[model samples]
Target chain A: MHIPDNFLSSPVWASLDALAVPAVAVVSRKAQKSTDSNRLPLLGVMGAFVFAAQMINFPVGMGTSGHLVGGTLLACLLGPWAGALVVTAILVIQALVFQDGGVLALGANVINMALMGVLCGYLPALALFRTRWKWYGVFLGGTCSVLASGILALAELALSGIRMPVALLEASLGLFAVNAILEGAITVSVLRAIERLNPSAVREEVVRSGRATWSKVIAALAGVSVVLTAAGVLVASTLPDGLEQVANKLGMPFGKHPAFRSPISGYQINSLGGAWFSRAAAGLLGLFLIYVVCALGGHLLGRMRRSYL
Target chain B: MRYIFREGNTQDGVIQQLDARVKLVLLIAFILSIALLARPSAVQLAVCLCVLAAIAAAARLAVIQVLRRALLVVPFVGFFSLVVFLSGDGQRAWSILAKSYLSALTVAIVISTTAFPRLVAAARFFRVPAFLVEVMQLIYRYLFVLAAEARVMQTAFAARGGSTGRRALEASAGIIAVLFSRSYEKAAMVYQAMCGRGFSGTLSRAEWRPLRVSDIAILSAGLLLATVVHFISI
Candidate 1:
C-alpha cells in the first residue's frame, strides 16, 4: 500500500499532502482535548508495534506475500484521530528510514492505507459489536474494511497511471480477500486472548470510546471535502499529474500506453455530461470511498473499546 | 551499523562541524532537484555526481561505508530500473533510471553522513513540533528492544518445531500478538515512570546554538545551484 516515488504526478501527490493537513489538524485537536495522557505513549508504542507487524509477512499464493495494513486495528486501539496520526507517522518513518515505500507516494499511501483502511474497518465493527452477533461484526468489519481499502488502493495506483488489467484486479482482490479474512481471524483471536489475559487492561488502555460522537460525522465530511476539492482541481486544470504529463511530453506514457489501458482509465465517469461534472463526480466518489472505509476503521476501533469498557 | 547512531561521539569531522540545518536543507533540495530532473543530460548528471562527491568528502564519510549502505538499495532500484527500458522509452527510459538512482543515492548519502540524533535535532530546528520530535526519538529507542523480542520469538518458534508452513503463519501471528501486548505493557510502565518523574507533554532539550553565518552561506550556495538548474531544465 506504500506507493513509491517516481510513479505519480506532483500535483496529485501535492494534492494529497494538502488534503491530509485538515484531517490531521482535526484529529490532533480531538486527541489533545481528550486529556488522555496514557494515549500519547500508546501512539508511539503502537507505531512501533504496527511497524513490526508490517515486517512479518504471511505467504500469499503465487509466491508473493502480504502483511497487515493494521489501520483498523490501530483505529480500534486508539481513536481515529490518534490512529490516523500513528499510522501516518509509521508510514512516513518506514519510507524515509526503512526505505520501504516511495517518498513521493507517501501522500497517496497515507490517504489509502491509513485513512481509508482505519475508518472503513472501524465503522462497521463498532456497529456490529453493539449487537448480539459480535463475531459477525468482527468478520464483516475486517472484511469490508480491507475490501474498501483495497479498492481505494487500487484506484490510487490507477490514478498514478499504473493500469491494472481487469483480471489482475480480480486476482489481486481475491488474494486480498483471503488475506483480510485470515487477518480478521487473527484480529479476533488476539482480541479474545487479550480479553482472557486481562480484560481490565484492555479497558483501561484503549482510547476508542472517548471519541466524541459528533467527531465521527465531522471527520467523514472533512475527509470527503478534501478529496473532492483535490480531484476537482486536478480535473479542471490542463495539467496532468507530474509523471503522466512528463511521460506525455517525453512521448513515453509508460503504463498509459495502449497495452496497459484499464477499464476505469482516467478516473472519469464517462456517462456524465461535461468533463467538469465527470471529474467532480469521480472526486466525490473517491472522497466517499476514503470516508466510508476510514469511518468503518474508526467504527471497528470503537467497538473493540466498548467490548472491553 | 553500530556507529551510525551512538550518542556523543561527534568525531565525524567536517560533517559534525557543519550546522545540522545546512545539511537538512541541502539534502531536501538535492532530493527535489533529482526528482524534478525529467531526463537529465549527461552534463546534469555529472554536475550532481560531482556535488555529491564533494559533500561526501566534506562529511568525511568513508566511501566504503556509503557504498555498503547504498548496496542494499541495489536490488530494489535495479529491478524497477530494468523494467523502465521494457516500457518502450528506449534511450529516454535509461535517462529516467539514472536520475532515479542518483536521487536515491542522494537520499542515502544524506542519511549516512548525518547522525540520527543530530538529524532529529535538525528536524526540530526546522520547526517540527516537540511532540513529533520526541515521538521519533522514542520509536528509534524502542526499535532495538522490539528487534530483540522478535529474535526471541523466532528462536522459540524454531525450538518448538514451528518453523514451517501453517506453523510459520501461526508463529508469526503469535509473535505479533505478543509484541502488541508487551509493547502496551511497557508503554504503561514508561508512562508510570515518567509520571513519577513529573513527565509533561513536552520533552525538554539542552542548550544549543543556531546555525552560524558560514552554515547559512553554504546552504545558500546549494540552494542557488538547485534554483539555477531547476529553471534551466524548465
Candidate 2:
C-alpha cells in the first residue's frame, strides 16, 4: 500500500522520513559493499523486471488473478540489501513518475515496503533453507513480507488519527491476510520454477548451508515483530485511552519531565487538533517503544556474540 | 512532443526555466509546509489548490490536466478518509484528504515542469547518495522496455488461452523466470557496454552551473509566501 501525502500527520510522516533515510542509506551501503564493481545497472534492470512482473497475472482458482509484488522474489534472487534497494528505487519511481504514491509519504512507504518487507521476506526463507520445508520458508516469507508491511501501513494510518471503524479495520486486515497468502503461494511456485529452469541462477548464499541458529533467531524475531506490530496497531487505535490510563496509573510522569514534555506528550499533537490525536500518539509511543527495546536488545546481544567469537 | 512524465523537459515555460535546484527546494519546502498546516478549512485548502493551479499555468502545463492527474492519489487517500468519516471524525478526514491532494498536486506540477535527470542532479547536490541515484536512472531508462516485454508475454498467454486453477499458476511462474533470466543477461550486456565506453561506476555529467541571482530570488519569494500561507492557515 503506497500511502499518499497528507494521509500522514506532520510528525508521523516527518519522523518516518527521518527513520527511512538512515535505514535506506545503511542498506544501500551494505548493498554497495557486497558488490565489487558498481553493478548498479543489474539491480536497476532487476527493478524493471519487478515492475514488469506486476503486469503478468497469476490466477488463484477463484476466477480471479493476482500479480507479483516481487519483494520476496527480489530478496531471494538478489541479496536482501540489494533487494531492499531495488524496491526503494521502485517506490521512488512510483512516487515521482507514476504518481502511484506521495513524495511526502515516501519515507513511510520505504520503511513499510522496502526495508521491513525485504527483511521479513528474507528471514523466513533463510531460516528454512536447509530444511525440507524450504519451500514453506519461501511461502511464509512472501506472506509475512506483505502482511508486515500492510499491517505497518495500517498502524501508520492509525497513528495519523484515522479512526478506522471496527468493521472496516477487520475488513482491511482480512484483505491483507488474503493478499499475503497469495503472495506467499506465488513466491514459492515462482522460486521452484526458477530452480527447475536454471539451477545455477539461484544465489549460492541460499543454496549453501549456513548456521541455522542465527537464522532461527532472526526468523523468530521477525515473527514476533509482525505480531507486535499488529497488537500495537490495535492498542494504539482502539484502546489508546485505556493504554494512557494504564500509563498514568503506573505513576508515569510523562508530562512533568521536560525531556518528555513535547507536543505529543499526552499522545496527542496539539497542533493537529484531531479528536484521536492523543489516541495515535499514545499508540505510537507505547507500542513502538516495546518494539524498539526488543530490537535493540537483540542487536546488542548479536554484536556481543560476534565480537567475542 | 510531450509525455506525462517527460513532458516539461522538452518544452519551455516560466517555471521550467527556473533552475531545477531552486524548484526542488521550493516545492519540497512548500509541501512540508502544507503538511504542517494545523487546521485546514475550505479557505486554506482552496488557496493551496489555487496556488498549485497557478503554478501549472505559469509552467504552461494544462492546468486541468495537472489537477486531474493529481486525482490519482484520491482513491488511496479516499479510502482511509472514508474510514475516519465513518467513525464520526469529519474534520480529520477532510483535513487529510485536502492536504494530501495539495501535496500530490505540488509534486505533480514540479515533476511535470522539471526534467527527472535535472531533479536527480539537485538531489545529489543536496547530498543524496550517488549509488541510489544511479540505480534510479537505470530503472527509469529501462522500465518501459521490460514492461513492454512483459505485456507481450501476457498477450501471448491470453492469445493462446488463459488457464485457470493449477496450470495457470505454473505458467505465470515460468513467465517470470524467463523474464528474470532475460533481464539478467541484458544487465550483463549493459555493464559490458558501459565498461567498454569508459563508464567507471559513475555516469559522466557536466559540472553544476552556478545558481542565478533570479533563481535565488524566486526561491526566497516562494518560501516566504508558503510560510505566510502556512501560518495564516494555522
Candidate 3:
C-alpha cells in the first residue's frame, strides 16, 4: 500500500505530503476531544495489540496467507482518528524500521493504509452503527471502508504516476471487488466479536473515562488529521492510476525509456546517487520529521483539552 | 540486534547495527530513486543495485536472508501484477517487472535489516500521533490473542467432527462470529482496566532526542546524492 519514491512527480507527491502533515495533526486533535481518561490505557493496550495482530498471517484459501488489516475494528473500538493514527504508526514501523514498504512512498502508504483505510472505513461504520441498522451498518460500513482504502490505493498509484487506462481501471476494479469481499468478511467477523463484548460498556469506557482531557486532545488531533488529509487529496497527483494502462500514451517525456538500462530507476527519483546509505538516511529523517510533528500536535491538543476542562 | 530485540540469542548477531532511522531513510531514498528512474538505462539500474548491495553488505545482510523475507510479497505482486509482465511487450514487460521488483526488493532490504519492535519504536520517536501509535500497539497485542482464540475454536470444531465440507464453511463463518464476540468482550475488559489509570486525552511517553548533527550530516549527504542523481537521470 506504500508508494515508493520515484513513483510519482514531486509537485504532486509533495502536495500529498503537505496535505498529510496537517491532516494528521488536526485529526489527532479531534480524537483527543472525544477521549475518556479511563479509556486511555485500554486504547494504548489496543494499539499494541493491533501491532501484534498485523504480524499474524492467517491462511486464506490456497498457499497464500493474508494478515488482518483491522482498520474498522480499531475505529469501532476507539474512533476514526485513532484508527487512522494507529494504522499510520503500523505502516511507518513496517516501512522505516521493518522495511516492508519504501521510504519515499511512506506518505502514500500512510494515506492508503492508514488515512484512507481507517477514515473511510471508520466514518461509515460509525455512522451505520449510530443509525437504525446496527448490524447491517457494521457489515456495510466495513465493506465500504475496505473499498475506500482500495480506491485510495488506486488513487495513490495514479498520483504517483500510474496511467490508469479505462480497461485497466475495469480490471483493477474487478480485482478490488474480490479483495473487498474477502476483507469485508474478515471485518464482520472481528466486529461481531467486538459487539458481543457490549457496545455500551465500550462507549462508556471511552466517553465517561477520566481522560476527558484526553478525549478533547484526540478530537483536536482528528480535526487536524482531517484537514491535512483533505489538503493532501487536493494536492495529490492527477495522473492515472494502476488501472491506467496508458503510461506510454500519457505522452510524458520519460514514459517510454529503455527498460533494461534502469532496473533500479523506478524506486528512486534519482538514480546516480553516490551512496544508498545517504539517500536512505534522508528518507528516515523525513519519516522521523513527520512523526515529530504529529507527536507535537498531539501533545498540544492534549494541553488544549486540559485547559478546556 | 540481539541486544535490542532480545536479551540474548544465537541469531542475535545476524542483525545489523545501523539505527532504525538511518536504515529507514536509506531505504526510502532507494525506493524513491527506483520510482523516479522511469525508463532507466540498464546501466543506471545496475548502479542502483550496486548501491543496494553495498548497503546490504554494510548492514551484514546475506542475500538469502533478504530474499527470503522479501519473497512474502512475490505471491501478492505476482498474483496481482504479473499481468503487467505477461501482457505487455516482452521488452516493455521485462522492464516493468524489473523496475517493480527492484522497488519491492529495496523495501525488503529495509525490513530484513530492521526488526519489527524497533521499527515501532522508531515510529513513536518520529512523533506519530499517540492515538495512531496506541492502536498500532493494541492491534499487535490482540493479533496473537485473536489467533489463539481462532485456533482454539478451530480445534473445538474439529474435535466435534464438524470439519467436513459444507460444514467447514459454516464452521468458518461460525468461527468468525465467535472470534468477534470474544474480541469484543476482551475489548470491554481492557477498557475497564484503562479507566482505573489516570489516562488523559493524549498518550505520552518519554520524548526521544531529535536527529543529531551526525544524523543531519548523513541525511544531507544522502539528499545531495539524490539531487545529483535526479538531475542526471532527468
Note the residue pairs that clash in candidate 2. Answer: A267-A278
Q: What is candidate 2's lDDT per residue for A1-309, written digit by digit as tens? A: 988877776556756776687677677767876774647888889898899888888887667778889898988888788899999999998888777777878999998999889888888888787888889999999999999889888878776666677678888899989999999998988778888877766656465434666755865686567658655756656764533554476677533221234345534546666433334344345435534654575457558868998
Q: Which lDDT tens digits does candidate 2 get at residues B47-131?
A: 8888888878988898888888778778878887887789898888888888878887888888888777678778767656667
lDDT preference between candidates 1 and 2, better one: 2
C-alpha TM-score for every candidate? 0.74, 0.86, 0.66
Off by over 4 Å in 1: A57-65, A139-150, A162-182, A201-309, B1-11, B77-87, B90-96, B163-168, B205-208, B228-234
* Better candidate by TM-score, 2 or 3: 2
lDDT of 3 by residue, A88-113 (tens): 66666555434455555566667666
Query: How does chain B of model 2 score on TM-score?
Result: 0.93
Please compute DockQ, using alpha carbons, for every candidate against the native two-chain complex.
0.30, 0.51, 0.26
- What is residue B164's positional error in candidate 2, in angstroms? 2.3
Highest-scoring model, lDDT? 2
Name the runs in model 3 displaced over 4 angstroms.
Answer: A1-12, A37-41, A44-69, A93-102, A123-132, A159-161, A164-168, A181-190, A197-309, B1-15, B78-96, B123-126, B134-170, B173-234
Give the number of the best model, judged by DockQ: 2
C-alpha lDDT score of every prediction, in listed order: 0.61, 0.77, 0.55
Give the alpha carbon lDDT tens digit for every residue of B212-231 in model 1: 88888888888677645544
Q: Give the number of the best model, judged by TM-score.
A: 2
- Reference-based lDDT, residue A253, model 2: 59
